[model samples]
Target: MGTLSGNLQRPVIAASAVCIASISSDFRDKFWPNKSSDTCSSLEQANSFSLPNSLNEPKSSWVSKISVSKLSNLSFVTRIRIPVPDINNLIPVSRSSSVSSFLYSSLTSSHALINAYQSAELVKAAKPASYTYDVSSTPSEVLYRWHLPDPKSIDVTGSSDCSSVKSRTVVVLLGWLGAKQKHLNRYAEWYTSRGYHAITFTFPMSKILSYQVGGKAEQDIQLLVNHLADWLEEDGKNLVFHTFSNTGWLTYGVILEKLQRSDSSLMGRIRGCIVDSAPVAAPDPQVWASGFSAAFLKKNSVATKGVTSEQSATIKEGNKTTVEAKPELTETALLVILKKFFEVVLNIPTVNRRLSDVLGLLTSQQPSCPQLYIYSSADRVIPAGSVESFIDGQRRNGREVRACNFISTPHVDHFRNDPKLYSSQLTQFLDYCVLTCCTSS
Candidate 1:
């Protein structure tokens, strides 16, 4: 129920010919545990409505039991009054015609829990005192300007060769959802310091939600990759990926899909990849829900050691006593309920929708590049076993795979927990990739 409430907060216009789709009874039980008659009546009414020409619009297989009139322009949102069965009337949202569609598309979600990271504390803390980078954007891509260090900074007098220092490599860093610029810059700095050009991209909450509902975000991803490919080809630069969380993994999975099917020689430009805390083949439904809630509430801050303790302290900020703050009122409870909805209720099917299952498709189609998997057993999101299994599979496929298992690092916080080990392993991996993989076909 909380999940539904969170998603519905934004103003969404209901078509004049509204038709209620079939929702699972189990979903109702979980969403509205109170078992109210008004809710059921609302569901019934919603499912019964049928409009003329409602069949013309595309219908999701899961939602095909009922027919709804298609809006003229799905992208155009407006204010409308709609009767919600058990709840109060939905307030109509108003926006100016002058506002750009892109901005509206990106900021549509009004869920506080999901958008909490918009003002995350970590972003402020991670901000560098000084930095320099050029920024560019296309309809589907955002590119940050970066450059290699001067070759004169390093000693080539006694070295056999210095072309590696002179040659520029592109490091694509895809940050997790709600990740702030400051947080990502910290990671990009590592590459830039070592004469590698770093380009960072962040997955916004609105964009991620599109993927959840099987929207056309994949096409946008292709556009972004095409933009990068053009640049890499023009400059003759090797490519490396540093990805954080499932957002990055899913984006890369799509890239791999295109690579395997197309005859584009661009695939050969990818030298290696370092995946950090991602590619969850199968996630625990409850944990998946909780992980999203926690990430959103915390504003995309990577969980670290003592985070649980920190949360326990913050949950007591209100005047409510520990007893008054019952378990049912906690974030965990809200997420468990939401999990039931995402996994069981509105499980819309889409082409290549393998996210809910295993990532074997991704691993199998993975480009023959050196791969490094970094994870921790303490991560509440990606399971350590899944990471290991992926590594084992890659090895079996005659691919070079490396693993850096931090004993207690939290999700996406391996670097924060142990900087030395993280840096050493990553630098070594890149060095090896540069020496062998980058020079290959």
Candidate 2:
């Protein structure tokens, strides 16, 4: 089914294993939906022998899967031999503000989208730029991973004085549906830079549904939290989380509550939590803020006022009534496209209950340690208010909450939005999660 078109021979351990850079179906589908195969889920869940795709002109019938032997170090790229119609050939006009802000994990996404934005003639276009992270690998990257044993396979030993709990570490990176692969690297780097082990999703998810962003993702995130606790309880190691976007935020809320239910040693190891663009609250408030943000996207940006009331109605009642967000295809031209995928995929009512339950546990019941909330005000996806609202609530409840915001762009492009600014905030945040979480008061 799959063939190793590239290097077939394996080199002995130079670095031994580099975190797999290969783009899986999840990464492909989310970024290049057009280039994706009919079978995306297959590749993400299971290693494909022959990923079915037609590359090169020869045999249209000839399909290929990924080579599992080189799974760890190999990077697989889908080479489209034939010229397919440009799915990314988005509508050639933008109407929002000329400045568009985005989560810039790489120059590829930033330059690509920005240039695309320049030629568009849709509504108003405010094209905010993106920024990338500056740090290279510190000898620190391996140190963190080395310390944390696998969540499912860590060992625990009681200390002589009983003052210390010797356990393996586990950190999970929960990403949203449409998030890019590079962001994962950002995550690994962020955690490693701070001396935290990088634990990828036991389940690597690149493509998630819209509207399903919140509550459902919460289940995935929380599962890891609880599962790791059980993992550490046996091994006597601690658990940490580095969650991204909606998926990660939802998980934080869920796991906190689950841990509060159990007051064992596992719960004690729940030291620090790192949240990026994670919304502890529901998307409705963000939905409300969309009116203002959308207008900011048009050619001539408008505030959410009487003059722009009609636009708001069009977005809310325009297409899918069951869903609050507009369709991704039609979502173009305007900033409506910036709506977080969770808003489109998640059910609001259910997500609400989960969020409320989590908050209640953190406040009314046993409290969690400090949580580092990292966000960008210019984030076009989740509102700045969402971050403010969640952090505010946490502080009020007597939880340790620190918030850092990256302005001038939307979503994940903190690096590209303003690299210098992004770097400064990111390292500081990393230091906080590492030192604060590891050291006991």
Candidate 3:
């Protein structure tokens, strides 16, 4: 029985020696291609002739004391055998040698090889693919839509020179709270029709309610800022910001802050700013409540409805009869509750700090570009008093300012209430900006 066992072991040892030699050769080729294949062949020859002194030592002593550099000088340790089941025949057992373990520990201890592998992985992970916003595709998770003008259908409203100027302009439309891509698309199309690239940005209500100082919303805004910076790198292209409500105004402030920090030169590319129904300097709880209520209730909100009066009058024009009554925002039970809720929420240390930081940037860090404020006295969400005060402050700071108060329109409803007047204001401002930009260049 002992002789039979010895004969079986001899054959197994011989096969193991051959397998170890092949594995060592493969490992050398993979990690150290410069190393000669003769090293592994010598290991196999030494294993067949005489085993190393380390094989006679205890497993713990050799494993603990072995160094990677010493591996090339030593032969295989043949005494250790780990039994592994053969996949083809379950009843039979195969022996795996200690050479694999030695090779693995040696590779792991090699700092240069490990660091090179890690660096390659990091580079592979760090590089982002180039992304261009395609208007034809569905909007991405960023919750913004980009529209490029069509060359064939460009509306040359005036001279050929004006058309050429408009072709190089971009209109950035920042939407109000709870506004969607669909809602902003109307405004976007208005610009696209005039041969201007349009980018409409809106924040989701979920992101607003769960707002954090440097959270997902800020990350998304950073992406837009980066894109804008890249866009400005092209020659002859400029931007016009058309902001709606306090939400849009605050977003614009954030964009301005980012641009100022990254590349202040890009801020010079902004030719004009069209502020619509916005710019409440500080964080007012009531204004926030009103804006949020209008967002939640939409058309049904008291903010959207006009006060009724017994004195109804109609004016007769050449072909149109105009109603004189104007919509007014009134306080309601829901509004009272929302106001109180926001009073507490807005005062939270983090929330207050974040809002104050943005407000500070808006007040002190505006670009030296032409600004147009189109607002309404009857806006329920943003108080006319606040808008006028902010406008006065900007004018006092020596900024080129223009303002038009749509006396009867609701918040951000100037365009929908009277398209002709709104369109006229936009057209004049865009033309002036383009002409000014061209003249300056």
Candidate with best TM-score: 3
lDDT of 1 by residue, 1-441 (tens): 234334643522231112122222233333333534342233224422222222223341112231121211111111222221111121122354422332223222211111121112111222211222322122232323243333333333424233343244668887775675567877877776665656676665555553432345666555446445444433346688888887777677766666555535777778889999876665446555655765666733334332343443543342213312122355556666769856753344442245642255566767778899998665666766778887887899898888887645677888877899999998888878864533342
Model 3 Cα shift for residue 147 (angstroms):
0.5
* Whole-model alpha-carbon lDDT for candidate 3: 0.64
Q: Summing lDDT over every window of 10 consecutive residues in candidate 1, give the lowest-scoring window.
A: 110-119
Error of 2 at 370 (Å): 1.5
Off by over 4 Å in 3: 1-142, 152-159, 306-331, 437-441
lDDT score of model 1?
A: 0.52
Best model per lDDT: 3
Question: On residues 1-441, what C-alpha lDDT tens digit does candidate 3 reach at each position?
Answer: 223234456655676588667765554333333334332223222222211334334463233344433221111111222121111111111233554454334323332121222212211222211111232111122356656564444533334555556666778999999898878888987887776778888887756765667877898788678656655655766889999999999999889989998998998999999999998999888999889888988987767754222211111112112433322444476688888978877887777888889899888778888899998665667877788899999989998889987766778888988899999998888767766544455
Residue 98 of model 1 has an lDDT of 25
> Which of candidates 1 and 3 is the stronger one according to TM-score?
3
Evaluated at residue 206, the lDDT of candidate 2 is 16
Cα-based lDDT at residue 103, candidate 2? 15
Better of 1 and 3 by lDDT: 3
List the lowest-lDDT window of 10 residues for candidate 3.
Answer: 84-93
lDDT of 2 by residue, 1-441 (tens): 001111222431222243333322234333344545442233122321221132233333121122212111111111111111122222211233321111111222222222122212101112101111122121112101112222222222222221122223446665543343444656555544443455555223311221242444445555445334434533445666666666555445566666665654455666567777657464454443343243334323322111123433443443322223342443343444434533542335554555567656544543365577777544455666778887887788888777776543445445555567666765565446444433544
The TM-scores, one per candidate, come to 0.60, 0.45, 0.63
